[model samples]
Target: MSIWSESTQSRAKEILAKYPEKRSAVMPLLYLAMAEDGWLTIEGMTEVAEWVGITPAQVQSVASFYTMYKREPTGKYLVSLCTSISCMLLGSDDVLHAIEDESGVPHGETDDEGVISVEHAECIGACGGAVACQVNYELIEGLTPEKGRELVRWLKKARPDAVNTDEMQELFGGRRSFDWAIQSDVGAAGPYPAFEPYGTATEDAK
Candidate 1:
């Protein structure tokens, strides 16, 4: 049986059609696969290889090269705290420790409940924002240690189906890289494809 659902397979066909060579569609197809499984499973990679006319090893090579691709299973929310020079100077390390205290896990580990995964990220291009982090790639800037702890505590307690970026920024953000448009009800569960969570009412409508 194919790893892709019918809709995903159809989408894959459309993505493949965009490229002259099937192998050229590997990246997008991998994104689709990741969106499907929430991570890059061996079976999904094999199916992608079959679709793209490439070896599974080749698919693995490409997937490994990209930081966005989640090779293992991640929690429902992936929290990436920026620890680059700018964020570091602004006390991101303290924020990270606060998050660790609240989430009960160190960076690069998921909480026992599997609700949140915390990791330290390199520069996420929000230097102007200083201390910044992303929840499933949605930027939240200007976090202090207290705010970080509060954010994690809220996430654990609320377990919200949709995490509104605008709302999060309004509540916890102090500085910003730039002015962002209000995004209502938009939520992300991963780092790729920029889509709402797969089975949400928003995604279902799309």
Candidate 2:
């Protein structure tokens, strides 16, 4: 009797098939569901659990583990900035300050307009890029003082009065990856699945 939509139910089937154990798909399913609906309601989890043939407990546990599953709806742009050792050493603190100063919102707080949410992250795994921040899961790296400012300026100009953009464009200095964000993995990138070069980010963009 759980009422998941036709599309979500179809995706649930695909996700379940990807895993030998149905339990393993719980997290990704919850993530997809939440991405569609914004927050992980108990009702939604129960519906997804029933679809995946897993206990509600499994669904709940999985949802709780990833920071991406918002218990509460977040801003239009969720900015997760890396504060790890490499980023920290490379002036991520100043970067953090720039973001805070420009956005006028404290870390872990959402702006009243609900346009952006800022939070600290452990690592984004782009150590070679030296410093980075994510806007709605798009990784922008090789941040210089001027580049960062332009990014902020550009974000402030987005329509619906948004402070983030969908395209993510290029860095102010252009693609800095050399092969920029490029890597090889049996003719593909280690972290990239679709085999595109000049693209990377450490985590799930969640």
Candidate 3:
């Protein structure tokens, strides 16, 4: 049986339409599958492969290489703490421990009800915001141990069906549509030639 729903399949068609080459749609399709299922199951990977005319192994290989794609089931909220040099100096370790203590789930694991999952991550590129953390891949900068605990509390009470805060709309909102990413600007915004022909400069020289 197909894991993809009818609506998801329709959205996949739209994403595929964006690229001239079908293979180029693989990443977006993979993200779509992850957003729909919360993790990339073998079935989902296979379906994506079929859509892009690639082998399942190829899809799996690509999926395995990216940290953004989760192989195991994750909670509704994924809390990732960055403990790189910059964040560690600012006490990211304490923040992680506080979350583990408050939620009773260690790193790489989820709570009993699967409300939240905590993990220590490498630099997430928020150096200025020391002790940076991510809830569902959205950076929550300048966090403390207390803040982490508060976040866990909020996530526990958060309803997926309820309206999410502006920062979290993407996660709670159903499957993502890439319609916003397609560029519509057609003006001559750059110095480079927009049309294809023999170079004007070369013709002038001749």
The candidate scoring highest on lDDT is 1
Query: What is the per-residue lDDT of model 3 for residues 137-174, given as tens digits with 9 covering 90 to 100?
Result: 55566777877787777677753322122233233222
Estimate, for each residue in 8-98, the C-alpha lDDT of model 1 and write its tens digit. Answer: 8888888888888899888888878877887778988999999988899999999999987788887777889999999999998999999
Clashes of 1: 0
> Lowest-lDDT window of 10 residues in candidate 3?
197-206
In order, what lDDT does every prediction score?
0.80, 0.61, 0.67
On residues 1-206, what C-alpha lDDT tens digit does candidate 2 reach at each position?
64666666666777788788887777666665554555567877887788678877888887788776776666766766788998898888887777777887778887787666777778887666757776665566667556666666665565222222223435343333334444322221111121122122122221
Model 1: pairs clashing at backbone N, Cα or C within 3 Å: none
Q: Model 1 compared with the native: what TM-score?
A: 0.88
Window of ten residues with lowest summed lDDT in model 1: 197-206
Residue 181 shift from truth in candidate 2, angstroms? 7.0
**Of the candidates shown, which would achieve the greatest TM-score relative to the real structure?**
1
Return the lDDT, model 3, position 87. 88
In candidate 1, which residue ranges exceed 4 Å CA deviation? 182-185, 191-193, 196-206
TM-score of 2: 0.74
